[model samples]
Target: MKIGIEGQRLFRKNKHGMDFVTLELIHGLQQIDRRNEYVIFIQPDSDICIEEIANFKIQAFSSLAYPAWEQWALPRIAAKERVDILHCTSNTAPIWSSIPQILTLHDVIFLEKPQTTGSSKNWYQRFGNQYRKAIVPTVAQRCQMIITVSNYEREQILKTLPLPQGKLKVVYNGVSRRFKQIQNKRELINIKEKYRLPKKFILFLGNTDLKKNLKGVLLAYSIFVENSETVIQLVIVDLKQKYLSEVLKELNLPGLQEHIVLPGYIPNRDLPAVYNLSDLFLYPSLRESFGLPVLEAMACGVPVIASNTSSMPEVAGDAALLVDPKDALLLANDIGAMLSHNNLRQRMIRKGFRQAERFSWQNTAEQVLQIYENTSKSRVTRMAA
Candidate 1:
């Protein structure tokens, strides 16, 4: 089968969750399936991480904008390449494409009401949300199959979009092997020195997104600091200092900034080390389809404290402490408890390792490949009939 995978942002440096998911999916497919021909369509950029192999080929397309690229360029290329299936890895896909398109609609968060208005998110985020909100429903209708990461997201999609019963598929996201516990003292020290990390800290991977609940995390950390006898720093990755300052002022926790460490964007390769160094990991998002970071942290042998809402409990699955994201006091108390109790922390770490072992890219890839094969066979059978 000739498969065209939409990996528009794959080649870019500093990838986010969706980009890593797509990248890992491609790598998994590459390792498992050599008979099936694959074409990975991506917007031209510098990262060039994936190399062309025997069955897998990298195809780059240059376009002025994301919508134009997906709408105009991607479909034309896929048709020209005569791909049997075009899998849009991201949430949005080409609406006009006649190809048997498969869309990985990560979540329908964009379609929901704005969690925060005004400057919570920048112009780029606002525009992207609006674009997805407009296009996802139409694209979801046209696509051959809609793949969501978690069961919670599957229900959300079912409720939000009017679709046939079997049109949607649920495939769990996998944690990469890179996120294993770091044993080497030298490597940990290098990463620590590289980021100038604190001696001890709680890690919260967040951005300016309102759903990330950065404000709540900051407030909770403030509460944790105020209540606890020992002061442990909070390390937040990929957040801008200027934005952090603004948020600090807004929360009236200007003193909180000193207690917080912003090491900016840590590369994906180095994340495992950061996870190892962290005393505890926080994933208190308001909502998530699949909390990849939760698993990633767990894989690195860190006890996690995640929000109880949405798919978090589904993903966490008793391996991590779950608390309501909205309740800053509760979150802070949990953080304190998790830190103070050695036995509880050790139990969580052990459970986390077991939980992380359950999900793997190979399994995810196999499931996806099965879907592709089924779709192809069904198409051929229809034609024969």
Candidate 2:
């Protein structure tokens, strides 16, 4: 079978969760089915960057508009390639296509939490009822198969949309092996100096966007530090400047300013060391399909404290402490408990390692490949019948 994958996110230098997802899927595909042909569909400019990316053919297109490419150009390209199946790591597999299609919907965050991003907010603000009336039903009726990152998200998909249960698949994500425990003492020292690391710091790794629950994290940190000032520090990375400024102003904090570190956008290569050097990982996001950072932290032997809602508890398992994201006081108390109680911290660390081992990109890929084979055979059987 000929498999085509969406590879646009490769254009980004600092790839996020989706980019990693696409890359790992390809890696697994090549290992599982070397004899079967693979075609990676990339953006035109990204072609040069991904020339060495895979041992497969690449179909490239150049376009700045995301929705336009998916709506208009993608199906034409898929048909031209005579692809047997097209798996979209991103959402929406061209409104129409001759080839069988599989869509990887990261989350229906746009559907569930419309205010989370600018476009969704605009769509809802301008045409709230009409947009939902038009798009939601269209997707439920037309799409062949649905893929989500976690059981939590799969449940959401099933609940919100009227679709057959068989079409939905839950394939968990894997943390890159590169994000393992830090070993190099000199590298750790250099990273500490570079990012101005604190002696004992609890770390949060997400953008400054409000939905990531940055404000809540800051309030919790403030409360935690006020009660026990000298125990550990708080590091906030990848926050937008505007949000950072607002958070600082609201804090109106004094010497606590020194304790709060905002080191912007750490390189992916350095994440392992960053996780290793920190005391704890805190992810207070109000939304997530699967919290990849939580898994990455566990791999690095870092104990985590995450929100109890959405997909977090599912991702965290029993490894890390889970707290209500809305309650700043409860969040603060969880951080305090992790920091002060030596026995609790030790137990979480051991549990985290075991939890991290449960997921693997290789396993996910193998499962997907089996689906492709089954899908192809079913098509053949239908023709025969």
Candidate 3:
């Protein structure tokens, strides 16, 4: 099979859940499907991060056009490459491309709730919304097959568009095995020294989107500081310091200084150590499709306390301490409980590893291959008839 996998997501830095889903899935695809002729379509200046994967080929398109290029230029190149299929790892796909596509929809947060309406609104315009409006539903309807990270997201797609039940496929996101099996002690010390991290700290990673419920995290952290005897610091990684400071003021945290730490975007390679060194992982997101860090924390054997909404309950399973994102008290209490109880923390680690085991890129890719073959055969049978 000649496949062209989109390489844009790997270039996205300081990205949260969906980006990781895309990057890791590409790695997994290469690992499992080496027999297939694969060509990764990257924008210029990608630098080819993963040198170890020798099975496939890497080619570049114009980085300047970037986002719009996927729809504009990549499709023509994909046809030239004679790609039997185009797996759009990112949600965006070419509207006019006749090539069969395997488009991955990580979540439908924007379509379900236009986040830019209320006080939660971040900016006047978000990237790719305009492109995605035409790209997503069109691909969901027009593509040979659709891939969603969660069953919850699949159901949401059904609600959003009238794609048939058989058209969609569910492939859970994978946790890097390194996260589950790592000796980050030296690295953790290095991270602490490098970042000047606190001794006892709560951790939150990823973008501070409206659904991420960072406001709830800040409020709960404030309550934790107020009620707990010990001073537990809260460290948020991968958001703009300016944005975080504004969030602090927004949540009235400037007055409560020294409780919060806003260190901007850490490299993905460095996150395992960060997860290992932390006291607990608090994810108070309003909703998440897969909840990547929750799995990352579990893989690092760190106990997790996450919001009980969206696919989180399904993703976290029994591995995490679920809390109501809106309830500051519940969030704070759960955070404290995870910190205080060693046995409970250990139990979470075991459960988390088990949950993390249930997903792997290899398994996900194999399932996708099956879907491709099934979809391809279906199209052929219909065409012949």
Clashes of each: 1, 2, 0
Q: State which candidate has the highest lDDT.
A: 1
User: lDDT at 305 for candidate 3?
Assistant: 90
Worst 10 residues of 1 by lDDT: 112-121
Model 2, 122-164: lDDT tens digits are 2433463344444544654566677789999988888777789
Tens digit of per-residue lDDT, candidate 3, span 1-385:
6778887656555455566666676677777776778788877554346443666777776746555688788899999998888888777788888788878877666566564212244443255555566567667777878888888888888888888898788888877876755564687789888887898788987464677787788888888888888888888886677777787887777855577776677877878887888888888787777787788888887888987888899899999999888999889888888888888988888998888778777787678767766766776787799
lDDT of 1 by residue, 256-295 (tens): 8888889999989999999999999999998889999999
Where does model 1 exceed 4 Å of error?
115-120
Q: Ranking by lDDT, best first?
A: 1, 2, 3
Instruction: Report every candidate's CA lDDT.
Output: 0.92, 0.78, 0.76
What TM-score does structure 3 among the candidates reach?
Answer: 0.92
Deviating ranges (above 4 Å) for candidate 2: 44-55, 113-137, 250-256
Q: What RMSD, rounded to one decimal, does every model reach?
A: 1.3, 3.3, 2.3
